[model samples]
Target: MADLVAELAAAARNHTALARRVLSDLEAGCRSAPECELRDLIATSRTVPPARWNQLLPGARGIYPDACWPEARLVVEVDSRAFHGFGDAPERTERRRARYASMGWTVLPVALRRIRTEPEQVLAEIEAAYRAVLSRRD
Candidate 1:
């Protein structure tokens, strides 16, 4: 038991170190993305694995959104069908959307296929959603 506890503690420390490195890299990369209206409008930010949402929220269905812009009240989720599979995907997504709605969050699910095939359309949708969220805030 003591050995297992020590191993778990070591793993946790390693994970934290890795997370810091990844976050630093992400911040550096973000500096290169084009500066735009959306970038200026962000309020709060967080990055966590989707499963962590359960810990973030107690009773209600907690969903770990891929990316969230809290100031814009937007939650962006990237869905890679290849990895996530396609069985009843839309239905499950809709349910998750409803859950977010119930929590007063605007959820946007960006499919990997669309991102690869029609990036412009995805950008347009994202911009439109941002605008809509902004409008609601006002």
Candidate 2:
């Protein structure tokens, strides 16, 4: 059992490394936990999983969403205080979300603080956003 646990840990480390590398190449990468990756993996069967795309939102040019399910027209934005949570950053983000909404993208902005406090709710909202977009598509 110990050996199996060791192997699993090793595999997880390897996968996380690969995931981080891929995310690094993209514009909007998650600098937090493996939540973004988990969402991608978990979204497989139930919905179109998100991936690290250099250009996630078309016609937006420099805007790169953290993760997006293009088929569902959904985008996930993770906010970090260290990066975009100070000064006018919050306001800028609100404008960005508004712009994305104008483009008909259902944006889900989750704060790192909120994720730490209400993780389950954040996950539930993500799923709900997926369902909302999915229903809109149909």
Assess the local accuracy of residue 41 in candidate 2 as a C-alpha lDDT between 0 and 100: 40
Worst 10 residues of 1 by lDDT: 45-54
Model 2 ranges with Cα > 4 A deviation:
1-48
Candidate 1 runs further than 4 Å off:
1-61, 83-92
For model 1, how does the per-residue alpha-carbon lDDT over 1-138 read when each residue is reduced to its tens digit?
Answer: 455445545675644765544343344232212211122222221221111211233234456555565667677666666424578876777787788788788777766666567666666777778778888889
Question: What TM-score, over all chains together, does every model reach?
Answer: 0.51, 0.63
User: By TM-score, how accurate is candidate 2?
Assistant: 0.63
Q: What is the C-alpha lDDT of each candidate?
A: 0.54, 0.66
lDDT accuracy of residue 112 in candidate 2: 68
Per-residue lDDT, model 1, residue 82, is: 48
Error of 1 at 84 (Å): 4.1
Q: Candidate 2 — which pairs collide?
A: none
